[model samples]
Target: MNIVSQEHQKSGQQPTEQVTYAAPYVDIEPAESGYVLRAEMPGVNRNGIQITVEDGNLVLVGQQQPLSVSGEALHRETRQLSYRRVYELDPSIDADRISARIDQGILTVNLQKAENLKPRRITLE
Candidate 1:
């Protein structure tokens, strides 16, 4: 995850705090029974991520835990960051049956298609 901190400090201006968010890379695939959404959010743990489906939109929110450094670091690469991503879901999906899980910074959301909307074959006797 690329974390960018917004620090506005001028010669005589007071520093202001700004919050920025990074969007995680996501992959969506269609399956025989449903759709799968996989998001890659490095530095984010399971407890730091939140997922919800609201108003036909799948919302993902995540925050990286802050690192406690005892002394000044010679080199710095990572930062405290937050993440957010939203995807508009189709009405054919069964929202109630949706499932989500996270493993090794990978978040997977399974959206099951509505039973009535699934393709089926009819036998003609």
Candidate 2:
């Protein structure tokens, strides 16, 4: 896993745009077949989260839009932040069986091991 402070991302208006990326806290739970990856991205909506797997890497991204108000600013703390995290997937993980869902700012990704890698009991003939 890698936590990047800033990264260059492409935008429609600008060919290259510099973005501040924050890595969200993540917890890994080990299971029989595989492990469950849970990422905590507060204030991020379901549509704003993106997950992709490519080149033996799993990428997670979260975007939070700036809050709008109809008055002069007095005190402001919360700001728009983009979260990104990348993890190197194991060889036993079945990329095709990976699935994810977001609920209450928590994104849960289910990583399943390939059938060939799973343990099985053999019966005596």
Candidate 3:
């Protein structure tokens, strides 16, 4: 019958394809003293993230794993995500003083400005 043939065709179809998402949701703000960067990375822990400064470029690399589920269902969707971002640092930034922390699924990176970069008071002679 037509119904039986349609059911067989549907069953023959392949499962849903997996997808990988890259991290691009980052916010950069310039404060009076330094620069702050906030990155949104859910389901990622501090151990999975890596930050490094090399050759005047700041790089952020991390991976996000898919959630696990129990019980079999009619349909399912799961995917792994990874991201890497490179930022060119300004000469005024003190790379040695840069620090980063992650809290509640948000990663914050603070880049301190060198003492020379700070505004200095100018007095007339």
Candidate 4:
């Protein structure tokens, strides 16, 4: 994931036109062994996307180009969009083993469970 400093908008400041981009949808699920995070980021390529983990936080960034139409345009009404989402990862996640892949317009991130976080069977004395 790309690391970007958060832009703080001043209070009462007029919203910028660039904020109209579509926000990606994300779903987080807990499995028997780990956590799965799926994000919907259509119209984005591998080069346009970035994912990074820093200070126990997972960050996702990407850009999407708006559809272009040329020649004899009578009516056009689609806007271009892009977005970013940052998640504060829990300590139970094994950050070093995290993996991600994009398929069918969905970005899937798997957070492996830390060795210490996994359940262990103990024998009674």
lDDT against the true structure, each candidate: 0.80, 0.83, 0.73, 0.75
lDDT of 1 at 116: 94
Where in model 3 is the C-alpha error above 4 Å? 1-21, 71-79, 122-125
Question: TM-score for every candidate vs. truth?
Answer: 0.74, 0.78, 0.69, 0.71
- When sorted by TM-score, best at the front, the candidate numbers are 2, 1, 4, 3
Give the alpha carbon lDDT tens digit for every residue of 34-121 in model 2: 9999998877888898988878889999987566669987987654577899899998999999989888889999999999888889
Q: Compared with the true structure, what per-residue lDDT tens digits does model 4 show for residues 1-125?
A: 32333534634555554343455788999976788999988777676778899777888876775556667868755334565888999888888998888876688889889998788998999
Model 4 lDDT vs. the true structure?
0.75
After superposing candidate 2, which stretches have Cα over 4 Å from the reference? 1-15, 121-125
Top candidate, metric lDDT: 2
Q: How far in Å is the alpha carbon of 93 misplaced in model 3?
A: 0.9
TM-score of 2: 0.78
Q: On residues 37-56, what C-alpha lDDT tens digit does candidate 3 reach at each position?
A: 98877767788789998889
